[model samples]
Target: MGVDRSMWKMNPERLQEHLQLKNRARQIPDKKKESKKRACRVSRRALPLFPSLSV
Candidate 1:
């Protein structure tokens, strides 16, 4: 279960794009975590001002 390197060499630009995509994919989890943290902070701040809306 390995990629064929020869096929990658046929188009360096495509390979570079693929590598960049892979790198971005790896950063997705961290990005999601940061987004969730920001969302939590926002929700917490809003909650205090909207206590009457809560059941």
Candidate 2:
């Protein structure tokens, strides 16, 4: 037996967004990650390694 659309009440826009996000979560990232990389902290001096390149 088919359920009436009105019985299962949810905002149409919210339902669509939820479904889209659910589907998106299943897909793999574009890059095939070998492993998780450790986050490295850089000091201000290191950031401008090449001053000319910064501009």
Question: How high is the CA lDDT of each candidate model?
Answer: 0.80, 0.60
Error of model 1, residue 38, in angstroms: 16
- CA RMSD (A), model 2: 11.6
Question: Over 4 Å off in model 2, which ranges?
Answer: 1-7, 29-55
Query: Which digits, one per residue and each the tens of the lDDT, describe model 1 over residues 1-55?
Result: 6976775565888878888887899877887789999999998887667668775
Instruction: Kindly state the number of residue pairs that clash in model 1.
Output: 0
lDDT of 2 by residue, 1-31 (tens): 6754763576888778767886797675544
- Error (Å) of candidate 2 at residue 5 is 13
- Model 2: lDDT equals 0.60
TM-score, cand. 1: 0.39
